[model samples]
Target: MKASRDDDPRVGLDGRLSWRPAGAADLDAWAALIARTAAVERPVWFERREDLAQILESRKNPTAGNSVLGFDVQGVARAYGRITKNPDGEKALGFGCVDPAWQGTGVGSGLLGWTEARTRQRFAADAATRAAARLRLFTEQQHTHHSALFEGRGYRIVRYYSEMHRPLDGTLPEPILDDGFELVPFGPELYEAVRQAHNDAFRDHWGSEPRDQEAWAFVVNDPLARPDLSAVVVERAGGKVAGYQLASHDAQSAESRGFTEGYTELLGVRPEFRGRGIARALLANAMRRFAAAGMDKAALDVDSENPTGALALYLKMGYVAVNSSMAWDREF
Candidate 1:
């Protein structure tokens, strides 16, 4: 069905539901809805309420070219859908949540439908630069209902991604590194280098768009970004990005959800530095950093089908497959 716009009661069934931009005033209530919904559904990853608030505040800024649509009834936000425009100008809809108490009342569908229409309209106006309009979204594999909802609205699964974990208590093998190339703390100076290495490594992979300087800087400066948990480069005598790793404590939400595990979010090695033990060295560096930070264990996810042999390398670094998620795609 074609989505409706323009202050029409058609935004939802009856005149009870309406759509509007999300604002700071709605974050507390929205987050409460998320917490309650997650407690009954899948894993609860968000811990700090303030952290979630900060993220929501960032999303509210339209200058970033991102938007949040909320379904409000009698002045209460019951559901929301957010779309963030990636560097490629593709709208990646993420983090949609609705109050479970209102699930079957048409709230979700309304929020989703409105967001899609707005996204399609916005992208359509930019046809001169990019002929094809792209709208992509992802959900956990266990979210059968979510996938069904998207598929019902013409969004097809495009790629399957898996989330895997390994126990840090297990004995780990030593990592061999090139002489004089040792793990260093991540700092302002190395942010660009790390970004470059990751961009280079992911250049040909699926959806391999690299983040711009501002995006990378936000990460390096984020309160959630822990320098101690990161491993970085110092020298590249062989003309490669010697090594890199990014590890961090569970985000406030994750920690509050009772998960204290650390995470290795990114690890990269330049092509010229591959096979010389740089990757393994970086992995070990991340693990040790987490261990020293008093975290009993650490975990990192990798694409099982990563073209860079990441899965095998992670396994060699004492990681074992714990859980899996898949990406699915169908053309519109």
Candidate 2:
């Protein structure tokens, strides 16, 4: 979509600004725009060309259903927004931001309203989905301006997720699984079980969404996914999956932040097997492996109010909160 006038419902394009659909060629410019916004807005997070490329690549379905828009002022890109659906198509998710210089202008709101409308359009494409669809956005809890924006726009805080890290320099205790359970590296034979384990583990988690095979496969097949680093537990009694953790890292992030680290992307213990130290053992094993790989630190994110007491467990394992963020949601 292209617009250069104030009457555009999707976005209020001020006279000097132009709105254009983002394309592959915009990857570098998009990275620069997002980097500038993050540097001033959420400094704890880092962005790379890969991140923007990933975004553009994810929503390349050739429709407004999943698209990004770049806002240019005087022929220079200064803002951007994107909207896409979750795997289940029950939610329309995206975010928008303006350069620091344009922060106080109406640009951010314009982009937000526009992105939300696109997401709604995605839902409206089908009556069955439109009736169940929702619009969601995210921002760090500490970024009060963002929270204010979401709240003013009728969004609510649905959950709090925190990232933590612990140094790997010191010796750590050996991992111990349940009496009949054993820790093993992920393999093709256990792929199906891994899917069941993750879904069952987070079935009751707040804001948890069920992931199908395609979604699950994407994570497993990502170039950065390390099957050797991932953890999976098998109960010896009946040979069922108990818990698992995904270990992956971004080369760009490691270089940008100047550190060697292994991130525990997803950790979950089956509901029937909760409170049995399964999660702890998996985490310890991951830490040990990361240290063996010469990683200086290990990191993970946990819900602040997880029913499984994961935050306490991570803290007990010497991890400290390095950043905090929340999931903001809206229904329309």
lDDT of 1 at 50: 54
Best prediction by TM-score: 2
lDDT of 2 by residue, 117-204 (tens): 7766667665556355578787776788888888999988888888899999998867987688998888888889989889898888
By summed lDDT, the worst window of 10 consecutive residues in model 1 runs over 59-68
User: Superposing all C-alpha atoms, what RMSD in Å does each candidate have to the true structure?
Assistant: 3.9, 3.7
Tens-digit per-residue lDDT, 1-332, candidate 1: 66446533225432454655555676676667677677655642442355445555452225123434345555665666666555355444445677677776766777666556556555655554363545566677777777778788877766666555655565655655767676667877777878888887777666656777766755665556677788776564643456688876754545444555667777777766677777777777666667667665667767656787887877766677666554533221
lDDT of 1 at 253: 47
| Prediction-by-prediction clash tally | 16, 0
Name the regions of candidate 2 deviating beyond 4 angstroms.
1-15, 55-64, 71-75, 87-90, 130-133, 187-189, 237-239, 254-259
- What TM-score would every model get versus the actual structure? 0.83, 0.85
Give all candidates' CA lDDT scores: 0.62, 0.76
